[model samples]
Target: MERETLHRYRDIIPDFDAFLQAIRSERITAVRWNPHKVSRARLIEELEECFECVEEVKWYEHAFRLGYEEKPGKTLHHILGHYYIQEESAMVAALVLNPRKHAVVLDMCAAPGGKTTQLSALMENTGTIIANDKAIPRLKSLVANVSRLACLNVSITWNDATKIQAKECFDYVLVDAPCTAEGNLQERITLMPRRMRESLSRLQRNLLAKACELVKPKGIVVYCTCTFAPEENERVVSSILERYNVKLEPLKLKVPHAKGIESFGREQYGCEMRKTARIYPHHLNSGGAYIAKLKKRG
Candidate 1:
C-alpha cells in the first residue's frame, strides 16, 4: 500500500485515522435485489435463512448488507440472477443518474456491468441502454451479467468511448471512468506512477467530455470513480465545467460522506466542488467512490 500517496489527502479526508483503519478492515458484503426477477421480501426471507445477518442498507431499499463471511455468489439467488453481489457504494452512481422509463442512456465505460444492470432494474427494463466498453476481455463479464440479470433494455457495444460519435442522443450518460482503484484498500492499493496518473487523468477528462457531447440538451451526466485522486475526480470535473455548458448539482445521498474539496493543494475548483460527493470506506463500511452529477443546459 502507498500510504504516502493517500496521506496527501489527510487534511481533506475527515477522521483521517478512522478512514485509514476503515480501509484496512474487512470490506462488507452487499447485494442488490433484482426487482425484475424476485420480490424484495421473498429474497430477504430466503437470504436470512442462509446468512447469519441480512441488514438492509438504509439509503437504498433494494440493497442489503451481509456479514463478512457471507459469500453471496455461492447462493442460489445469485445463480438464478435474483440478486446481484455488488460493492455497496458502487450502487450510488446509477441511482444518482435516475433515468426515466423509455429514456435513452449510455454507460460510457460499462464493463463487468454492475451499474448497467442496476440502471436496467431502476428503469424497469423499459429504456435503451448502450452499455459500451473498450476492452474485449471485460466485455465477456459485461455480456454475461447483463444476460444473467435479464436486462432486456441493454445493448452491448465495443468502442473507445472517447471516440463515440453518438452526439446529443442520450437522455442520460454515466461516465464511470476507470481510475487507480485507490478506494478498494481492503483488497490492495497499488502505488500509482506519475506517468500512469497523467495518462488516466487525461483519459478521464476525454471520456467525460465525450459524455457531455453524447447527452441531449438538458440531459444528465454522472461522472464516477472509485479513486480519491482530485486529478481524476474534482479536477477532471472542474475542467469539464470550464469547457462545457453544464451545471453541478449537489448529491443528496443518505449515506455518510464528505463534500468534494474546492481546493486541493494549489488548485482551486471553486464552490461548485461542494456539490460533488466523496464516499470513503468508513462511511459505508464498504468501498469508496467519488460521484459528480451534472446537468446540461437546454
Candidate 2:
C-alpha cells in the first residue's frame, strides 16, 4: 500500500493501525449457503464431516464464516451448487436490498455474479434478473457461477450498463460499480493509478445515473463497492442524489460498520450520505466494503 493511499484513510478510519494490520493479516474465508440448492442446516451437516469449522453469520442466516483452512470451493457440495464463496462484508448489499420474490431486478456490472446469485437466492429463483456486464471474459465466469449456483432466474447480458436504454423497467437495481479495489487488500493487489481511479469513478457515476433511470418510481437502487475511497463510494452517490429524485435509505444490517464520510478534504457530501455504511476489515474481521441504499422518490 502506498503512503499516500494510507494517509487518505487515516482520519476517516478509526484505529488506523488496526485497520492497516487487519488488511495485512490473513483474509477470512466466508460463504453464503445457497437456499435454492440446499438448506442451511443440511449444508452444515454435510460440511461438518469435511471441514473443521462451519459457523453461521449471526446477522445473516444463510451466510457462514468458514475456518481458515477450509476450501469450501473444493468440496463436492460446492460443485453441486450447495453454497457460494463470498466475502462476509460483500454479502451485505443483497441482504440490504431485500428484493421481493418475483421482482424484476438489474445487477449492473454483474460479472462473477456473487451478488447476482445472492439476489437470485433472495428472490427464490422466481424473479427476472438482467445480469449485465461489459467485459466478455469476466461475463463467462459470471455465467458459470450462475449455472453452478443453479440461479435459474438470471439472464446474462454483455453491454455497457450506462448505455442501457430503459426507464422505469426494474423493481430493483444494484450498481455494484467497478472500483479501484482499495478495500480488497486481502488479494495483496497493487495500488491503481490515479487516472484509472478517476476513470472508474466517472463510469460509476454514469452507471448509477442509469440505475436511477431504470428503476420504477419509489423503487430501490442499492449502490455498493468493494472499495473504501469516498470518491467511488459516497461522492459517486452524492453526485447521483444531486441529479436524481432519490434519497439515501438507512442500511439496517447488524454487522459492525462505520458511517460514511460526509466530507473528504474540502468537498462536503449531502448530509444523508451519513446513512451509507462503511465496513472496514477491522470492524468485521473481514474484507472492507461500502454500501449505500437509495430509494427513488415518487
Mark the regions of model 1 whose C-alpha exceeds 4 Å error after superposition: 1-3, 187-190
Looking at model 2, residue 228 earns an lDDT score of: 82
Full-model lDDT, candidate 2 = 0.88
> What tens digits encode model 1's per-residue C-alpha lDDT throughout 85-177?
999989999999999999999999999999999999999999799999999999999999999999999999999999986679999999999
lDDT of 2 by residue, 215-263 (tens): 9999999999988888889889999999899999987879999999889
Off by over 4 Å in 2: 1-3, 187-190
Model 2 reaches what TM-score against the true structure?
0.96
- The positional error of residue 76 in candidate 1, measured at the CA in angstroms, is 1.9
Residue 32 displacement (Å), model 1? 0.5
